[model samples]
Target: MLLELLLASVLGFIIYRFVYGDKEETLPLDDGWWGPGSRPSGREDESIRPFKVETSDEEIKDLHQRIDRIRLTPPLEDSRFHYGFNSNYLKKVLSYWRNEFDWKKQVEILNSYPHFKTKIEGLDIHFIHVKPPQLSSGRTPKPLLMVHGWPGSFFEFYKIIPLLTNPKSHGLSDEHVFEIICPSIPGYSFSEAPSKKGFNSVSTARIFYKLMQRLGFQEFYIQGGDWGALICTNIAQLVPSHVKGLHLNMALVLGNRYTLTLPLGQRVAALLGYTERDIELLFPFKEKVFYSLMRESGYMHIQSTKPDTVGCALNDSPVGLAAYILEKFSTWTNSEFRDLEDGGLERKFSLQDLLTNIMLYWTTGCIVSSQRYYKENMGQGFMNQKHDRMKVYVPTGFAAFPCEIMHMPEKWVRTKYPKLLSYSYMARGGHFAAFEEPELLARDIQKFVGLVEQQ
Candidate 1:
């Protein structure tokens, strides 16, 4: 009897630890100041200021001169993009940028929506706030905060903004209209970079939470991909009550026991709660998950360790900067593009749109600051952060994009987001879903919102 009681007690303890531990807890909302100098004693500025994207003739002249001065080294015969951005294809992109791409017009498009900046945590946080142009009678739009990842700006959502804010105008369902707020992650584009060390995703989440509170939104929906996904997850972890719904195109749920079993073969993976779709996306494990990560993570290793060294060169040369950033656009959009001569860039995006993104980095001189984000987030180690161990209590939704660097199965997502209410396998898209397939992404967001509202 004593032995049986001890055995029962051990099993029950394990069950309780697995099922109840940390489920209802939230991350402590810590304070931070990222400005260069010491924190000011008085309250920081809380006023929002109107902002515009501007460029002078001198800026245009300097860009043209740099393009003209570019020296090309011929790519290996028939190398395609296997090694990197092919110099051969880069010449064509540079030619278009120098001769035809219009910066002033793109700038005008950038300013079409309402752009504003407000001081938060000693930084000028830049964001575009777009309200529904027209709404149905007796209905108000839902407030949604969408964040962009590294090497991407608020511009990624420009095409998707209209679809969400005015679905009826786009011939879609008008049931779920949104008041969209897309903010540049601090140090990415126009948002100011952190001067101090240890400014990680948790700090960003707290700052964005403060921003939403200042905007008079006590509750709002949040969405993101890449780094944005992690930051938004932190937000949900920090303040579960404030976040109505958490949606993501990508999820960082690796390094857990579930993921460790991925290498046990498809039969075991299926037995471990992975769906058929998950098996299909994750199998051929060596190529799809392991080697692919090894191949694509070189830039991450560099940025996480010694970003300033490379940032110096990228900031100094326009052509070099284009080659560095645009390479990710090519391969990340579709890994198979590496086999094509032009990296299949023109298939999904126009040269004008691509260069416009590159120009944001060039003009802002923010490449170094942006690179430092990787170091702060992952420089210490992965899976060691407090938020990583915490499960989010907010209702969550995930869109599993087919070619997103690495595939995240719904089973894995549910581990971190126990309240996951929707998980859709997106029809088509890769890392830059909003920029590449705006209509598809918008519809998915509507679908997720509908489900959340029903609950």
Candidate 2:
């Protein structure tokens, strides 16, 4: 009995150290953000065409055909054995993707929403621009730009677009309608992969700021999660003049401040899950986020240092692609299914939906490019310093997800965003909030934007 207790204590101490010991290392910058001109070139021009939209039947049909072909030949089921996955027994995921995965159906579904493309800073940016159905009735929709993170695309917003753009469709007030524009981050999918080395988060932020200006939106609201949150915060700092407000999932630099100031009890609570009061105060769900981070985020550590080494394999092998990307679908969603083959894709996302996202990476040959984002950004420690927070004057709202890799309590977040307005503890959802819990995320965005618009 005493030995067992000693083992438990040692295990707990190790986890606590692993979680809290690493303060972000400050790396020397090669080239700082806006070393010359802080302000991005160009202003909103009334005559500039916002975007070129081509929803022709023939083009849409070809996309559907491609989706059909992908469904016919499903991904290899060798992720466990090849990738050294802990579990030996794999789920019947292949049968589900082949038999049940409806790609043509999903393409038509995605095409139902309007799509647009525009050039900004020598890159072609793809986005979905959904306007409220009642715009002709003289109610102007608030323009909201939603950005997706790594391993995600503009498709993440498909579920939440209607809920935000046409609130009445969701049985919500028409007064809360929004004009949502979700963009694929550069190098992710449809958006052009940057051909240079210095295209980090700050650069993406600046280019996106230009995209917004080209769209004729003088003022706009911003929303994002993961890498999206990092870019959005940079936008808030870079173009405070144009961005009216900012909302984010997975707060960044804010975590740094918590390590610097919060009380010891709160710090311990943040690091190790101990106090019921802290649990009640922070996350409502009793999910084990730390284990998933350790297991799933091994890729992040690799990508940070030697992205090219692993990225080359993914770039070459289709089976390698499935193992690298699809594995996250299992562990990141929750702790209970950490070893499951399907990774609980069916629980929150349809087979077709999940496969489509994977296919986007596959078809674009962007798996390598996307992983390179980590090398360019983290390898340089941009997030640790260059992208550090300034005094953000714009209104801000934050939705704290229950199963996110990290938690940033309101008190901790205030260290960076001193003017924070809304902080809500999300009842449920993981890191991929837009894709997994779109309705809830959409509603929260509308509620927060409604408050910002009113102000």
Candidate 3:
């Protein structure tokens, strides 16, 4: 009995030591987590300014007339999709967009939000800034910058903006109130398109750091999903001191092909639940990963190889634009709804809200420029680019969405973001979490910041 008691005490002491002893030390800012890559030292070409957004009454009338024409014309019958085109749905959607979608109203709705444009690293970055209505008697409103990804816009946070900024009114203010700033990544929306060839993720990070500095935010929280995650990660790495914390919906790890192809034994263990703590610590998403990779990665292959060729067609044709964006809306949200025509978008979003995002791209004629994002980042030898580095030190929090096209399990995420603090498996939400599940996302964001702040 005494021996057994001693063994139990020893085991308890060992477990306690393992849990609490010799914790990982947070790195200092001077460690150069941003890496030592040479950033091009250049000035903005004053000659190339942001294009004037045509929001005049006459312009609105002209846009309505063009949409009306597309509606009146009968689309090609015998609707087809995926492999080719869906003429029937095309006609229906165009009719709804032209006759019912109300672009003028959407314009006004967009104007309702406080929008601003600022110059950053030779680009005019556009962002929506909404301040909380009330601040505690002594506290100033905290700034939070939310970024959107490709095939998405700042519109992703339209719903969440109100919830964050005026939480008392929305019954969530007590939970969390954020002075929200949602930016349309350069080349995505009102933001100025990059004038040069080499505007990749890391460059964006540096530019945004300068932006926050200009805005007088010595420190602020950052949040993003999709390519937004890339920018957030970059910001954290580039200037970890200025960035207070980062919350990501799509926490992608910039891993090489080595991590992509794990060994057979580890793979089997992940499936059979026989993987050891050491092995399981490394391999997170072994089960069902193969299925996701095979099913939803057609666009990656196409974009990586031939983006410009595809961008040209999408830019010119309105029908092509709808097809490209809508297809992703369907497949990415949930695989169960993969075969459905609408992709179950209505399950989380209204057709009106969905069309607003599409119309933004269509009207701006920036569809091609947006697709070029892929080309710029995925161009020849991009992975092997001299500036490529995967170390990030920002206080990072990640939400693992079950239905995301690419899943980055916690262990895998730790490889790229060694400072990762909080990891949660989101019960719901897919790629478009901010849009599809704002309440849940807001809760997670609050939790993430709260934990990091406490630390």
Q: List the residue pairs that clash in candidate 2.
A: 330-343
| Model 3 bad stretches (over 4 Å) | 1-87, 173-176, 254-267, 271-287, 381-389
Which is superior by lDDT, 2 or 3? 3
In candidate 3, where is summed lDDT lowest over 10 consecutive residues?
27-36
Q: How accurate is candidate 1 locally (lDDT)?
A: 0.88
Q: Which candidate is the best by lDDT?
A: 1
Give per-residue CA lDDT, model 1, range 163-211, as digits (tens).
9999988999999999999888899889999999988899999999999
lDDT for each of the candidates? 0.88, 0.66, 0.67
TM-score computed on alpha carbons, candidate 1 = 0.95
Lowest lDDT sum, 10 consecutive residues, model 1, at 1-10
lDDT of 3 by residue, 1-455 (tens): 22232344345434433553434322222211121234345643323222334456675566557545553233334323333234455666666766687767788788778777776655667877778776778767668989898799988898888777776776663555688877777788887777666667667767666666667788999998888887887777667777888888876553422243343557654664432543533344443454555566677667766767887877766656776787677667875665444445567777688888987887777776677777777665433442233456678889877777765667667655667898887887788998898878887888887788688
The per-candidate count of clashes, in order, stands at: 0, 1, 2
Q: What TM-score, computed on C-alpha atoms, does each candidate reach? A: 0.95, 0.77, 0.79
Q: Is candidate 2 or candidate 3 better by TM-score?
A: 3
lDDT of 2 by residue, 1-455 (tens): 22232344345434433653433322122322222235355642223234432234564355445434432233346553334332322224444544565555666777787776766655667787888776656667888899988778888788888888877768866776788878888888777777767678878888777778778898999999988998888888777778888998877643343332222344566565434534554443222323334455678778888888888877765445654666666555554554445456567777677777776776677888789888878785432443452445678898988767666677656656766888888888888898889877877877787787677
